[model samples]
Target: MDTPSSSPYGTYVIAVRGFVAPFEIGVYAHEHGRRQRLRIDLRLTVRRTAPRFTDDVATVLSYEGLVAALETLSEGPHIQLLESLADRIGDLCLSDPRVVEAEVSIEKPHVFPQIDAAGVTIAYRR
Candidate 1:
């Protein structure tokens, strides 16, 4: 799953999810002491026909590679906010030539004791 971004869309989109990756991705003191699980979801826009009809794998994005690159990012130093992380992820998605747009969501479940779930989401286009 480790490779530079690429796209095969003439006009298509892919929704991909990489389950919880433990990260120190918050501003609070307690949040920095240990890693917390974060879920990453991506909505990638691409062209549908060009690659599908051509039957060329290289004509489209590589889901495996995308996941690997993201995983590498997760392994790095903790970020302070999901907004920044989502921004970085959106940039990464745009790295693919076929991608016209991307929306990224980084979620931290149970962020607040009283709430059922809370996290952050961000989107980018190019």
Candidate 2:
């Protein structure tokens, strides 16, 4: 089967890393009633016609748009699972016709003291 990574069109990568935010997420009882610090990292692969010099922002994918989409998702109802959150992010990234694939990672920085962080990573392709 043809894959997004193997597409014939030139691929442009957009990434956002170390995006920390307060989120209400988790399945355990202690995880309820408050928001925790969550770090989100995303990398998107978009299929573009070709590279050309253009001053217009509309012609190319905007990182602001990706952040806006994430903000919108974060404003929605509480999410219980990291997998679900990753899926939602992937869906948002894929919503753009130009986007061919997305890789998302969600981390809870304060979950444990011994370890750095615990989280989930997922990938989706159109």
Candidate 3:
């Protein structure tokens, strides 16, 4: 088995995509006082030392942990821009010592009727 710490590239990827929810985010005067649909996509490249067969959850990174981190951010103060949000998330992902890189993408789907979505994607590396 390919463990998180022992990958062919000396790294492994964890991805969370299409995580959609409603959040209070925007800078427009009309964007306040209401929640808007938001989508978050994340990919984390983590460093690994070796592959081991272990049953412990602490042995590897968890997607639930990532979602919880994102949820914590969402519950905090409103964000004005997707870029800031993506940056913040990137930082959060890098907080883990095992994570060497993070790619964060945040989108606002209802920004315009004609457009499918508007968003920003950012990458962070340690």
Task: Give TM-scores for every candidate, taking all chains together and pairing residue i with residue i.
Answer: 0.83, 0.89, 0.86
lDDT of 1 by residue, 4-51 (tens): 233343466688885568877899998886888888888888745454
- In model 3, which regions exceed 4 Å deviation? 1-9, 53-55
Candidate ordering by lDDT (highest first) = 2, 3, 1
lDDT against true structure, model 2: 0.84
Candidate of highest lDDT: 2
Between candidates 1 and 3, name the one with more favorable TM-score. 3
What are the per-residue Cα lDDT tens digits for candidate 3 across 40-69? 999998886466537776777889998888
Residues 36-102, candidate 2: write the lDDT tens digits: 8889999988887556537788877888988877777766777899999999888888988889889
**Candidate 1: residue pairs that collide:** 1-68, 8-59, 8-60, 9-47, 10-47, 11-47, 11-48, 12-46, 12-47, 12-48
Error in Å for residue 122 of model 1: 1.6
User: Taking the candidates one at a time, how many backbone clashes does each contain?
Assistant: 10, 0, 1
